[model samples]
Target: MNEEIELKELLQKNKMYQQVLDDIEIGIHVVNAEGKTIFYNKKMMEIESMEMEDVLEKNLLDVFSFAQNGYSTLLEALHKGSSIKNAKQTYYNNKGKEITTINNTFPIIDKGIQIGAVEIARDVTKYERLLRENLFKKGNTKYTFESIIGSSDKIQEVIDTSKRATRTNSSILIIGETGTGKELFAQSIHNGSNRMSKPLVSQNCAALPDSLIEGILFGTRVGAFTGAVERPGLFEQADGGTLLLDEINSMNPTLQAKLLRVIQEKTFRRIGDTKDREVDVRIIATINEDPIDAISKGRLRKDLFYRLSVVSIFIPPLKERKQDIEDLVQFFIDKYNHLFAMNVKSVSSEVWSMLLEYEWPGNVRELEHIIEGSMNLLEHEEILTYSFLPIQFRNKPQFQSERNTKKDLDEMLIQKGRNIKPLEEYMEEAETYYLKKALKHHEFNVTKAAKALGMSRQNLQYRIKKWKISKE
Candidate 1:
């Protein structure tokens, strides 16, 4: 009976303990003072692609060659009886598949002396995938309620209201200035809503012609119109999903009535078809203009406005959300870093102050362009200075419409006997004028003219073809 009790205790401490390790999802392994793998779990076995018999008593470096750099670092940590957490690691298997992992290593202690070490690692492949989806996936329906990245209370209220309305299927209307990301809010509403699992189809009503818009919204029959190729409209395509009508105010009044009918009856008729099709698409419309004003201006129908105004959301302009500028700048910096394949580390404080002080009349889109242009113009520098920005922006213009004041410039040209000139002819004349000035500056040297104007030899040759100018 005593012998049986001793056997039970031994099994509980060793084999039973090993069974507990086997049950865990984390890869658990023990390494001796010499850095040989003394014991390993089933999880570790899978990671190393080795059997228990194959891995035991194997040197950590011999078993995993990629761990050579990490072995010395981990040994130092173990010698000091300290624990390392969340360390990044990568390994290549015999099949050459790269596996990324997050590691936690703790020094094993017995009798107040460091003996060896126990390491635990969790495979981060799925976590990395989720991160990628969150960052880049257009259809991702999951983001934090506060992730909309606006500081204005007006904008915050829109986010708050959207969150409250997520439990219902009420249609949303997001109003904002151009480039304010109205569709971004619409997507947030769809993702937050109960019907998140369904699709979200977007259409810019203004981008399509009136003839094509109706068929695009309602779909078409095999012979819907002259040379009518059958195609599904926004309603049918978004069935059991959400339909976003971007620039809704720009949609034709006739189509507006059809859309109102669909919203009211949840049914629509395909062009050249007698049958009405039922659909379950949630409607979200965005307009850059005020709906009340739009109705008064004959831009939108009052009845359609009332139907969409059930759940209205208004996004504030970028200037109002000034506090979010830094976060947004960082967000774009990280975004462009990967996109442009440059290692931009930071933006200078002076450049940031310049960004803050300037009134962003064009909002986030303008800021994004400024940053992108700066990245393109500058080399691989650690800091982005204000001087790196475009010359037009460095001098900075006061708040004014982006519309050309240069309409008079065209009129002036017409009055100067240039009215009948073709565009290419005008371009050729302009190029010749500039080329002559540059050549005078360079004493009519072709190489000098090319270098001074930042034009390549081949580009200069092409311009000369259009210029019809001779060096003689």
Candidate 2:
């Protein structure tokens, strides 16, 4: 009778433990030493699109055939008593819905004996979908000329020139500073071209090493090297279509020479192949710095520049297009309204004045981030006021400087019966003032603010925390 009572109490404790796991956000699954499903939480059921009745007391290999094939972390942990952390798992469920998750799996040991294995998973399907849409979707354009927000003459001229260039097959080079919407213009040109029905492939020249980039652009034949396999390169895949080369100035000189030959002859050979392969890909390259400066610095070759500059388009920085700031602000407001489910209608006059007066060194990208951050913090207000702006905007450098002039300080001191405070106190006040000013001037961007202040970013962050300064 005592044994039965103890067994019932242990079952109750296990039930309580399972209930606790179900209430948590992460998916959890526990398998016994024999690889049988012993416990599965509610979140696990939701993530896998399965039911409790289907998984309870069933062999994991029977439920997920991949387990028996030695492809599952739980099975591996069960057999090897090993732990796996942050391993990516992608699989298709019974209903044919693809699922992607990051998993941490480990063995459950009790008193020096391996009892079972448990797995914790976090879903990342949505993020993976967004990444695929951005990087690999063919014949799909996410932006066009209509999506370009500004109506300023400088932008309009570039748009017109880009549209004209799309009607031909000549090589085109785009020049602008960072955040000047280079990719946006490139995609627009691709969509507007006669080859819109074909694939539009793109690669960033600065994202990989020279060896990997060569293989990615020109492909490699089977047995080209120790581990190389036959593959189709971007030029061949984009045949009869368009290929966008972003940050072209970052390409090594040797790769640039090969690219020049491909552009001139419309043909390129695989890494280990002797015969040349023909392709009809129209090339569009982008540079975020001046071409002449790049040449002088040996980052780019003059011959390659001449070949790519058959037609060149320049995108003006946001500071030079101040007339478009108001429009761009309104556009971002509407965008966030839809994204964040807010109802912000307009900006206060003071907010507009401050926006116009500020020099947008980071250009349109920075403005978008500022508006998005402000909108995220807004609550129960229809109009965006000065208070809704970030603390950096509220404490601009010009206003702070005017408030700290010697004349104003002397008048304030005189009002205090000509009494002076301790030198330490005055020094602390000055330090606080300058730190805030530097942060505000950089719009609370830690790296840029640190660079402007001649300090490390970690040091700046420490001082900001010490001063109890709020970025929002």
Candidate 3:
């Protein structure tokens, strides 16, 4: 019978079985229910630096002190009648070299009762080494323009234009809403330029006060001012490279004039010093505001705008390119899997639909944060559910609802005009018409409408509802 032959083969455990184990790439060990070592592959014996005779009658735990934890693990698995696989850890070899390995273990059952454990260990030293050497690994400084993840036509066009702009050393100005990855494009330009190997100093013009920003942009000379310390500014630090000026629209006009001079003449004077310092730092400035409006409002200078706009790169907002949402979700999920040490593998269709429908006013940064939050809240299962998303995303208002509300207001306005009560009444009707149009254009969101109209939300809402207009 097959059972008799199988039992005989298992009981024999002869030299042929040892030969098969020795030929495997992974290490293997077989122990009795009493945790005594009965069989070990050649690789395991070599790693332990022991001869077959020495290990023959010895308990595995007593022979190898490092394997005590493994014995506990085996006992737990045997008690539960379940297999424990892929227990990852780093172990020392015979030469005392650390090697990463994954242990795949199964219980040896007899007559439906758990007995001992057989463990197969596969070395993952090279895999871990490859993960370390990856350019996209955390804190790696090798990111270039190519790291921008998008295949949309608009994004590709922006990349092409940015590449052309980087080929020259001309000053570049990137304009986009917040969270639009302006700095990513700046880094790409720097890497594509001849200054790839040189330092790319970054300065946030809006994060510091005027005096501190000036000091950081232009170095201060020691002994030239009271308690002044000598140090090179960002311009000097980025000499022969690039200096990114983030939030350039928020910078004062005085600083704008000074920056314009540096870009035009390649020279700047440190604080409390008369002599000019020569530098070859390429300028890459970003602004969330429109340059024309910024210059008109006197927050920026026209000359500086002209100087920086010679090569302009504009990053489109996320809402305009709805096609990228799916890929971005997958990318963020993969990122969070490694970051959170999770097994989460898939997302639900309902979650994807909710993502596609929501108006991402905060752009890609917001999406990334949402994904991270979702991953943190998810349990051990491999699927991401709709409930994991933010409440606002799940309940996004439909476009038809918006249009229906707009039509209601338009009909009310026309009905008032048809009455022909007085010239003042016509004026009132026209004013309400335009006000409702403004609100509708801004998604009937009083906060956004108020901001666009330069009025408070309560004031705008009072006026609209006073006219008996329904937001729905």
lDDT by residue for model 2 (380-400), tens: 787788677877756879645
| TM-score, candidate number 2 | 0.56
**Highest-scoring model, TM-score:** 3
Indicate which candidate wins on lDDT: 2
TM-score to native of every candidate shown: 0.56, 0.56, 0.57
Per-residue lDDT tens digits for candidate 3, residues 1-472, read 9999988888778757778889887777777776666777877665455677766666543344221111334444544667887886543333333355677778899997767777777767678646644643658565577577665557778999998887788889999989888998999899998999899999888899997889899999998668889988999999999999999988998888899899989999999888998999889999997888888898888999899998888899988665566546656776777777787755664465456556788899999988988888887967788677666555566734644664785666566546645766756675577677767888888866654443335445546865777665
- Model 3, which residues run further than 4 Å from truth? 1-136, 395-472
The deviation in Å at residue 257 for candidate 3 is 0.5
User: Residue 383 of candidate 2: its Cα lDDT?
Assistant: 76
Per residue, candidate 1 scores C-alpha lDDT tens digits across 363-463 of: 88888888888888878785788668877787665312211322444454455654566887665554576667667767777665654443334345445
Q: With candidate 3 superimposed using the best TM-score fit, by how many Å does residue 234's alpha carbon deviate from the native?
A: 0.7
lDDT of each: 0.73, 0.80, 0.74
Candidate order by decreasing lDDT: 2, 3, 1
How many residue pairs collide in each prediction?
0, 0, 1
